[model samples]
Target: MPTLIRPFGALLLLLLLCPLAFAQPLPGVIASLAERAPWSDPLEALGTLSADESVTLSATVTKTVAEINFADGEQVERGRLLIRLEDGEEQALLRAAEALSAERANVLGRVSQLQDRNLAARADVEDRQAQLDQARAQAQAQQARLANYRIRAPFSGRVGFREVSVGTLVTPGTALVTLDKLDVMKLDFSVPEVFLGRLSPGLALSATSVAFPDEVFSGEIATLGTRIDPVTRNIEVRALIDNPGLRLRPGLLMEVIVQQRLRDTVVVPEAALEPSGDRHYVMVVHEEGDDHRLEQRSVMIGERRHGEVEVLEGLDEGELVVVHGLQLARDGLAVRLLGVMDDHTGVREILEAHR
Candidate 1:
């Protein structure tokens, strides 16, 4: 029994000694000191680009299309004639009404002259004047009916592809074309109710799209939804972006970020975080008497932007945290400083690798 116990003790001692033998200062491990800086938390959300004003042009009355005055995809001014329907019959009727109105006016003039000469009854002159007024009203009504055959642009915008051509019969409410005011773009996005205080009219924001990865569009908040959506607990936000170059289009998907007021906070590289289950930790290096040692510290993280993260708790300014070679880090183990993480490009390269 004593011989067996001695062998087991030796085996246990060897297992313990093996870890000590392998323990050494981890080389090439990048480390950086945390610093307090102005941090502006950005809210990320998906957004959609829309036209400041958009509509599908349609006819208000059934008529045969006689002429198309504007070309497809043309930029038109307000009140420009776009479609002209068959108004020949209406024009003829208007001409007849005008002729009748002219005859009534002549009769009214003669009646008034006769009344002045004491050769007509006052009642006769009054009756003639009434007839003249009715004739003029009838002519005006006919002229208005003739104007209905022409469809004009309601606002200044770029026209879309027309669905109808000349001589096509269109019914009331038939879509003729689409018109969009493209000088300014409207971006619609939503944010959680928790961010309500941060959202307001005139707030600035930046947006990006997959189509234009290098370009960042800027805009200002134009409006906000009156109430929060019960299902999502989010409020809708609308922003207006100027499209001077006509680069942005309606319905484009965009990633939007709204900048908030800045506050002083501790910031660190994202690579330094070691996520374990629901908790997060970072390998921290501390000076103990004559030796520098590694320690694992749990931290409460806040917002993340670019390649950096805001540490809300468990860290202070000027404390070094391991950023690279974290696998080699162990609590209470001695470690060597490879270099400051900021001195080398490793942190940036690591952050951009997945991007």
Candidate 2:
């Protein structure tokens, strides 16, 4: 009976030690130490994209469209003829003016010759010269009137769909088509008046559109408003973006980011942050002798970029933060440090690989 009790006691001891065996330190958790670095404060705002120049092509005179020189949505250079209107009457008037001017010029020359020969009075020569000048003025006016019948592009740009076809009669201000210089884009956005001190021309900016989520466009501030809007207390700002690819169009909405200033601050990998409701926290590794443990730390975060975040407070430089295996981290729980992540690889790639 004593032998049987000894065996039972040994079995009880083995069952009690099993829990301790299973509680050994967790191995290979990705981590990195916090470090101080330059952090740029970014101001974000929404902006609208516009062309460098845009206008609606229209005829100045009411007349039938004699010829359409451009197809719908054609790219044209400056002074390229787009439309020609019927100019029969205007052309006839111009011819008549030219003929009258030539006749007056001849009479003036004859009168001058007669005056030289002492056959005509000086008053008569002066009157003939005045008549010639009047005729020339009328001819110039007629020429200008005839020019209105032809419409040409004022600048190099892409034309929109044609509103009037050949033989279509159009009047002044009639809708013809839109023309826009799309090689360069203008971005207009408003920022709060408080940022006025930091605002200036030539500041670098970056923009992103919802249509192209993965792409970013770079530009610079081109203009600033003189007066702030009283109602919103915001000032308007314009930026010029080069669109050599011709991807951005007028009226496209974009998110604008302006880097205002930079300062040295504590930062950590983005994966170290653990969100709880509206609060953020991180797991800090504590080293004591041969044992490594975790300490739950609440961190105040600031600017974020790429795969890193700025730690405003609650963390010190050189403190190791768990960048992976957050679900297994607990306060005072033993863990094994696999290695330190010193590179700039994004958090998503790390997580994807680990998972």
Candidate 3:
């Protein structure tokens, strides 16, 4: 009886020790502290670029081009002479008018002196004055005609390729070249009429171009259309972007994003969310004495951006949430905290470094 009792006690002791020896260790997970960050709803649209100021230069009269003062793609100043046409006839007429005007002035002065000495009649003095006035009028007319032979830049800007060269005959309204002010660019885009209430001058926006995939351009709204299109139900918006480097050109297509409705809210990593049907859940690390346990909590999420989610409810600032090894996380389960992730570091980097 003593041998049987000893064997049974030993078997019972082995059974209890086996369960403890085979117990699994706590699961490891990476967590991040929930923090408040600035959040905004973004509105996206496509935009077309244009120069702040643009025009095509043309000739005002029919004449042969005598001199081309600007080269293709040349920077010119306002009122700079760009083209000179053959003006020999106009110049000759102006010279003749000037000579006649001088002769008339001499006659008028002589007649006035004679009238003061009682040697000439008053009618003679009046006739001389009228002749001088007529001659001066003719000279002024000739000068006005001569100005049509020259073409000058209307504004300071870059000139496009020349369409005509020296000795080429050009008629009135013939296009000579294109001039554009490229120091600033104008971006035009349309937004739905529903956003008209939110649209205003001085609103901030960002733009990107396929031609420059790595570059982002910043700008602000300059104007909003007064009326919305009845057919399209959209309104036009214009933005101004500085182009100090002259990298942007007219007619380039760009993608634009407008920042709207900004607020500061509690946020967490998107990876920490576990979707259960229509509800989202997160494993929050709760401290109990010296041990850390996970508490499964449902969260109300709002806007999502850049791998981060805005937590509208069921979360608080400075609370730790699991971001990695989520499969091992469970309510009331003990977890080994591997590390904490920051705004810049990734979970894979933290895990590799921990190992």
Model 2 alpha-carbon drift over 4 Å, by segment: 1-39, 262-268, 271-302, 310-355
TM-score of each: 0.66, 0.71, 0.83
**lDDT score, residue 229, model 2?**
100
Question: What tens-digit string does per-residue lDDT give for candidate 2 at 1-355?
Answer: 9989999999899889787866754665778989998777788999999999999978888899999888777889999988889999999999999999999999999999999999999999999989989999999999998889888899999998889888898989898888999999999999999999998898888999998899999998999999999999999999999896787899999999987775799999888999999889999998889778899989899878988999999999999999877888898888876666776764566556666
Q: Which 10-residue span in candidate 3 carries the lowest summed lDDT?
A: 17-26
| lDDT ranking of the models | 3, 2, 1
The Cα error of candidate 1 at residue 145, in Å, is 2.2
C-alpha lDDT values of all predictions: 0.87, 0.89, 0.93
Q: In candidate 1, list every pair of residues with a backbone clash.
A: none
Residue 30 in candidate 2 has what lDDT? 71
Model 2 lDDT, full chain set:
0.89
Candidate 1, superposed: residue stretches over 4 Å from native: 1-39, 262-304, 307-355
Candidate 1 residues 1-355, lDDT tens each?
9989999999899988798776654454668889898888787899999998999988777889999988888999999998898888989999999999999999989999999999999999999989989999999999888878888888998998999988899888899989999999999999999999987888778899998999898898899999999999999999998887677889999999887765899999988999999989998888788667888999999988888999999999999999877887888878766567564566666556534
Worst 10 residues of 2 by lDDT: 345-354
Which residue pairs collide in model 2, if any?
none
* Candidate 3: RMSD to truth: 3.8
Q: Please name the candidate that would achieve the greatest lDDT relative to the true structure.
A: 3
